[model samples]
Target: MIDFWLAAGLLLLVALSFLLIPVLRSRRAQLEEDRTALNVALYQERVAELQTQQEEGVLDAAQMDAGRAEAARELLADTEGVAAPRVTRLGKPAPLLAAILVPVLGLGLYLHFGASDKVELTREFSQAPKSMEEMTQRLERAVAAQPDSAEALYFLGRTYMTQDRPADAAKIFERTVNLAGRQPELLGQWAQAQYFADGKKWSDKVQALTDEALKADPKEVTSLGLLGIAAFEAERYQDAIDYWNRLLEQLPADDKSRIALQGGITRATEKLVASGGQVVKAPVAKATALLKVSVDLAPDLKAKVQPGDSVFIFARATNGPPAPLAAKRLTVADLPATVELSDADAMMPQLKLSNFPEVQLVARISRAGKPTAGEWIGRSQPLASSTTAPQTLTIDSPDK
Candidate 1:
């Protein structure tokens, strides 16, 4: 920001020079005009003296003419190199006043309308924060500077949750939902924050939020974790085990939280056994969905497309979000090849194929390797996500 202001000040100085330089030059021209007038007066005085001598018979006509010629020559010599006086419609004071007002008015307008606060926020974020508190302060200022920024609000809410300010986190998450739409992940965060904010007591509003999130995305991790905690707190050990097991399945092998989550499941299972209740394991095979697809270029497009062009095979929910439930990547040369898209290939855990009842398969050919859009595309009819039969897709039509 300091560098930016310095550059702006330099530009202002350049602008002021344009207005000031002309005035300074006009002053120099005035001085030259005044000196020329003074020399002409001195020449007239010498001519008057010579005429007086000739009238008194001290000099003849020829000598008098010579004397006048010498006086005129001296006047011309004194004024020889002087430039013509400049004519200005606006005098010195006007340009000087303009020079003063240009910067002042420009600065005033810029302060009122420019993105200086955003610039400051950017500069602050470039440095590593010394502490969490300092980072929080910067995020708060960023949210204040850009109230409409959903991404900033989401981060601030997460930060508040880490700081144990659940009430603040809940409010920020609500704002985030309003600005960014009721996304499953955002809904899960909002529900978790609201649950903690209400002193760990469940409410109808929290229930609604969690239900909506899970309905949209069954594998929403935050909501799953939150429900497990709620069930445990309510002394429903079996219910806690169920929710934790569902969450555990969604986690990756390398996730640091997996150890703690496994411990939680074990604790829940032990408590359920102590209560003389039978523990029922969830059906693991039913939870995993896989689609086998054979993709190939259309006969008509074979001559038009390069063999090295990229091909994307993916499945998206027919009745849910536009995001792919599962996807695969290959090259055009690999066409007429078989590929598999499973829950393991899910773009997001909450958007897995097992979470949706029905989906559509799409195959696209793109020179740019982008999945969302491409030159040629083919789509299969809506089919059950749990379908075991092989599907065939050919890239036959231009992408709309």
Candidate 2:
């Protein structure tokens, strides 16, 4: 901020110079004009003295004329190289007034419209925040600086949720939805916040938000998690377990949150069993098959794809239905990514990798965000699903 102000001050001085330099030059020109006038007056005075002497018979006409000529030469010598005074329609006061107003007007306009607050926020965020409160303050300032910024609003809403200010979080999330569109993740966040903001009671608005989110993406993690929490709070242990199981399927095996989620599922199961409700176990394969594949865009096809294009990697039985048994979705930016597909990643509960003996691996890049249809694709020859070696897949051929 010190440096910022110093630079601003330097610019103001530069502006002031434009207004002040002309006034200073005019003053010097005025002094030269005065000096020239004084020389002329002295020359006139000397001529008058010579004429008086001639009229008093102390000098002849020739002597008077010579004396007058000598005075004229002296006047010219004294005034030599002096410039004519500059003509100015506006007086000194005008330039002085402008000098004063220029800076004041500039400062006023900058204060009213400049991004000084945003600049300060940027500086503040460059360092790790000392505390949650400090972070919240910075986020608040950021949202204030850019009210239309949906990203800032989303982060601020999340921060409010972290601080347990659900009412504020709900309002901020609503604003975020309006600015960023009803994205599945944002809708789920809004529903969760709104549910808590209403004193932990579910409302029609919350229900609608969650429904819309889940309809768009059945595996939306936030919506699944929120629904599970709502069911647990309402004492519907079975529903909680079901919702949590669905979310568990969407999570990667190595996800950090899996442990906590599993614990929640365990609690819900205990409650169900204690209430005399029989818990049915999902069928588990005796030998789970895991296929590790590294996917990448071919160098020749790189120029034909966008970074945000969807990439779908899957395995389907070579002699079975076209539907993928296990699949993972990513963006082209995540290409050159190594992904593991197992029964846990099955598209349907009935479809599992262990059920298939021989499978073909496929990787496709789709600009239209579709998994089934794409512009470029790659495929691996039939291999045992239980193969332990990691296979490399490159999207180099046109999809047919």
Candidate 3:
């Protein structure tokens, strides 16, 4: 922003100087024209006076001629015309003095008061407004200026969203939908605004519109993701999985859509398992340490999964799961259910508590149970050593 402003100001100053040059030149030329005209008139008048005097016999022809010549010479001297010596402004002191002083004055002023850091033009325009009234006025004016303008309406809807007036935003977006005719891209944009602005009440409507958008362009990742979200909200887990999984294929190799798709999978699977699953009692021990595992699933996700697959928690045979240790699962209400992995009991599954102080733990899972993705979480000791306790990570809920 600063660089842009500096360049702009320099260009403006140069342009203004160019524009001023013609006006100054005209003033100088006008000064010369006036002086030339005055000298010509004076010379003519002096010649006429000399002639009149000679005609009246007050002086001889030679005397009159000499007088006329003298007058002409005097006039020429006064006007610096014929036989005038050259005057050198290049050697003048005042102008040189002014040149030095002008720069010094400019430098002083700039150092004292004008070296601004603020890039003061439309930079302010880029900052979002805090007040809704100003936003409303601007939005209204923009929409009014171009009645059938899809972009204008879209801007207005965004403004409304920023102002927390989703209902109003919905109205504007509906209008935008109407204005955007059959242009699929524009229509998709309108539908997107409408979907978000409608908030979850019109889920079915959003679904229909987004479907239409996808039909127009199957590669619309944004609409596909939204459709997945809507489906999840509506409790259609399989359909949500389909939408997000399809969306994942359309995403760039390194994108969050794939992660989102995986997360959705984890969530659905967890819910289904928790709803009804058999639990074998694993005994607890006298000495125990908490294991928190950091799992990175699907580094480059090609498909979306929701909780139909099992996630196996494993630790390094010598260092826990590569990096992260194991911790308890977080409930949706920000509650952590106690999960103890080791104790001094025989029934407890081959758990060694005294093994690795540097627990390199990982959470591994699979897409279609083909292979597991276990991401490294650093040692639990640092988190355990912090002055402030780490918050429990809530899992698998949209609001969370």
Candidate 4:
């Protein structure tokens, strides 16, 4: 019952504040200006009262001293007609106002102009099959416009997988591989989809695709990574190291890639050591020629240069004829192409002429199907004999 009274009193006081607040604020301001006069008058009255009480033997001198000290330090207790709190209204807390306003504006602006509703769609995609169906239908329309679109089919499968529609995605992936012929990244995606669909079961097709990818391009980094994992799973320690080494070679020698590469290498190397096997290296070839190259373009470089555009770069060799990569026949369609010397376009390897020996370097950039520009960087070496051994050329050293 007391608690109820207290709560009711608090609410009543709050309800009365709206009518009393402005007047109370004005009175407080007036009190600040007139406080000294009022205090002095009160002190005078207290001194007179103390004297009267002392005369009647009520308060002693010590009590009077304490009273005066307290009177000097504090305002007198409020009486019935005492002025209310004063001052030109209190200042609002700017930080509190900003805290409320900031979120309102930020969320309002973000929804109005910042992010698309599509971002949410991707997040809750599993709940919305209709959106996925529409996306697939749109992709079908696009593929119909271009019958030979391998990339489109690949994208379609990826969309279906993202929506957790595995069966539909599997069909699309199967079709994409047939159209594109062979793509390592696409194959990886297909295998990954199957693994996810079957609760992480490994299929023979996965292994076959990985092998074919590595054969298609020795520098296929992702294939090398898959091969490394497979080799480790099979307890082929040296084979794992060889595959990881290929991946390491293709990675940039920066702090990020260096740390990851070294970590993988360390793992494989440790396993190889435990098995008493050596990590395999590329066979070294003996020759007395070299080529130097400086890249002027990067793969996936989104510049003004587009597909079917002419591209150019400079190269040099140290020994023989730069016959194969004619400067005028270079083009851009040969993606991820290396600069090496060639005799009538028959490509061969070479060293950097310092720490390694073996050179037959040529430089060429192709546009569509024809070479648009090229230049030999060093003296070329004539091909003497074909062998499995190819020397590792050091591209790190600059002419010093």
| lDDT digits (tens) for residues 293-378 of candidate 2 | 99998898888888899999999999888899999999988878999999889887656788778999999888898889999999
Candidate number that wins on lDDT, 1 or 2: 1
User: Each model's C-alpha lDDT?
Assistant: 0.92, 0.92, 0.54, 0.55
Compose the digit string of candidate 1's lDDT tens values, residues 16-98.
Answer: 99999998898889999999999989998998999899989999999999999998989889999999887888878999999
Query: Which runs in model 1 stand beyond 4 Å of their true positions?
Result: 285-400
Error of 4 at 267 (Å): 1.8
TM-score of 2: 0.71
Select the stronger candidate by lDDT from 1 and 3: 1
Tell me the number of clashing residue pairs for each predicted model.
Answer: 0, 0, 27, 37
> What TM-score would you give candidate 4 relative to the actual structure?
0.35
Regions of candidate 4 where Cα sits further than 4 Å from its true position? 1-149, 156-170, 191-202, 254-258, 274-400
Per-residue alpha-carbon lDDT of candidate 4 for residues 59-112, written as tens digits (9 for 90 to 100): 888987787677655545433356554334334344345545655675578668
Q: Is candidate 2 or candidate 4 better by TM-score?
A: 2
Which 10-residue window of candidate 2 scores lowest in summed lDDT? 278-287
Model 3, 1-400: lDDT tens digits are 6686577567656655654555555556667667767887988898888889888988898998898889788776766743323354543454445555655675578657762433332354467867778667756865664578788788888777777776787677778777776455545555566666666654566667777878888767667777777777776666666676666655556665567677986675565456573323234334554443333333333134344443434333343333323323221122122233332321222334433453333233333342234221211222221112222221221111
Which ranges in model 3 have alpha carbons more than 4 Å from their true place? 1-165, 168-189, 192-196, 203-207, 269-400
